[model samples]
Target chain A: MAREKFQTLTEQMFYILLALQEERCGADVMALVAQITQNRVAIGPGTLYNLLEDFLAAGMIVQTKTEGRRRSYTLTQQGRDRLLMEKQRLERMLSDYRHMTAGTEKNQRDTAG
Target chain B: MKRKFEFNLYAPFQYQDLQDHLEKMAGRGWELEKAGYRLFTYRAAPPATVRYAMAFRPEVGWMDQLPTQGQEIYADYCRDAGWELAATWSRFPQVQFYRSRKQYPVPLETDLTSRWRVTAQWMETRFVDPLRGDVAIGCFFAIFLAIVLTIFLAQEEFAPPLFAMCAAADVLMILLVLNQLVVLVDAQRWLQQAKRAAEEGSPGPGGRMSLPWKLTTGLLIAAGAATLAVYVTNATADFGFLAPVRIAGAVLVFYITLFAAFRFRDLLRKRGGSPHWKWIVFTLVATLLALLSVELWDWFTDF
Candidate 1:
């Protein structure tokens, strides 16, 4: 099967989608992404706001609630599916790399002996 | 002692320049107090280090209720991210200012894509939409110019100097509009490149209007104003005080019609949720009313 566009997510997109798995406000999403990524991926306010707008527009996320000025959003079914697809794609690449490296290590050990 | 205020003008597209200027002002103990179209007002304050970041949001408007839902949410997000709302300019692009005192400035938009998207959206709504509107305005101007030319040509004793001056001014006005259209096209091209750069994860080149374009626009406006002044002076000289009075009335009517149309459009946007139709209707009605008022005044005064 041909992979769909955006089946592979950027590091920022992955963390953002991962954070949105549960309902959260934009500010909360920033915090969660920073925490989950251990400060390695920092999504600024502007990026979070625009990405959320894009996600909502693309039907990847839905606004769940609006409490005063803060709007809460969660991943839509499509978003979850995309996230899972990316996870599987990443897993396959890791598995291939592991297999290749394992064979090379074993061959090296045989040659050394 | 009262605090002193200073006015500074910056080009709208020079967002980086605006930020740097504001920072420089802050360091000079002149903190930004307000922002208007092409103008910034600063008040004297204790010297402090403040970093300014600008974000463009087109959904916000001057007439709309302050702290709108989207605006509030965005402000809160920025506040949480260490930025404090400093000022807002309710113009096209609808710039919002954020200031931070941190040692390292934290940008509101970290990714190039988001930054480009905001700017591109601003350009589309403000420039592109207006460019579409300009077509109708251009047609109307063409008809008006044709009528003026016909009236002058039909004169039994056409004075070449007067006709030539009037024709020159009309041409300049048309050229002004065309120059604006060119600027809009250039702006659209810049935005497209910016979007492409964003997609490639690089900061796009900032948009800037050409110096020649700016100078031409300035020249055209000055010429138009000078021509208008000359016409008014000649009319007053020939027709006594009545001419000035009539001219003032006409100018008043023009402004009043403009105010009413904008108010009507804003009112429709607030309630019925469709302002585009409001704009179209108001424009047509305003033009009719303006023409009718001028004709009726002329007839009543036996001019």
Candidate 2:
């Protein structure tokens, strides 16, 4: 079955929403994402612009202010809920990994002893 | 400034090729100044390395000369990122060319999936839809021609020369239809492959002037030439030595009228006064000029 659009966010989409958690302009959001990720994930200007447009259309983000071409955006409650849901999904996956790996390590130790 | 003009034949989807070609020209001390329908103008400049990016704005009409407010804002965003709007060409999916001013500027697009999505939308709007219309129109004409040929064949006095001319024109139309079909299929295939790569979190496919494309274009040109030859030969029987002259005059009238309309539009744009109604004005002017040219040609030929 096909999933709904934005139902499962891509890594870039996730980070863009996280960046908009606080009101930030487009370029600032881009710089903040790179800084937070320690220069690991770099968002291109075109990509950021497109994602912001989509977020605004999807009602996940709201435009807080506009100065000339510079516009600032912040995540709405819907956006925060979406981001939290994705975080929980990732946490569950991590917990499952830990549970499986811990049992495997314990069994190996038992066999060795 | 010294300038030169050349016809660009790359398809709209072949943005990579256009970008590389412009960069190569810039390295040779020529920089792009403007782009119009099938033509690029370059001015002499010092040799430099420049990165080019193509951004598509599908909302822009094919005849739109003045940029919209949204387009200006988009350019503003790109400008802040070290890219400057170099030229704009109003193809079906209107495109703007941006050149990087700084050394090793950051890429305009980074997300593979987002890039693919934008490109796919442009392709669907400009390439697939238009080609489908062309193919359908071609099929309708082919069927009409077939019916005409059948009726001619049933005549009591079958004329070999007329039949031969019809056959030549038929071959030309068939080649045109076949070329359109090939392009449609190729575009769909490219989109499918790009989609798969994007799904895998990789960059979409890059476009090139493939061999098949070249061969198809060559074949269409040859077919057109052959059809024209048959036409000239048939007309010579009725019009004496003036057949080829008449044909050339008609072609001249068509090209001159088209060029005049576009040049006028460009002049308005340069003066920064092109309004939305310019399209209608251009069309009316072109039609009048074409009619005048045709009438003058007939009078000159008769004289």
Candidate that scores best on TM-score: 2
User: Across residues B72-103, which tens digit of lDDT does each residue of candidate 1 receive?
Assistant: 77888889989888876634326778888886
Root-mean-square deviation of candidate 2: 4.4
Interface RMSD of each: 3.7, 2.1
List the DockQ of the predictions in order. 0.41, 0.47
Quality of candidate 2 docking, DockQ = 0.47
Lowest summed lDDT across 10 adjacent residues in model 1 chain B is found at B1-10
| Residues A1-113, model 2: lDDT tens digits | 32366877787899999988889988888788888999888777777777787889999999999887778999999999999999999999999999989989899999999
B114-221 in candidate 2: lDDT tens per residue?
A: 777767766777667877888888878876785676666567345776777777676766677667777777788887766665565577777776677778878988
Instruction: State in Å the error of residue B293, model 1.
Output: 8.6
Question: What does candidate 1 score on TM?
Answer: 0.69
What overall lDDT goes with each candidate model? 0.71, 0.77
TM-score of chain B of 1: 0.68
Question: What proportion of the true contacts does each candidate reproduce?
Answer: 0.71, 0.53
DockQ of 1: 0.41
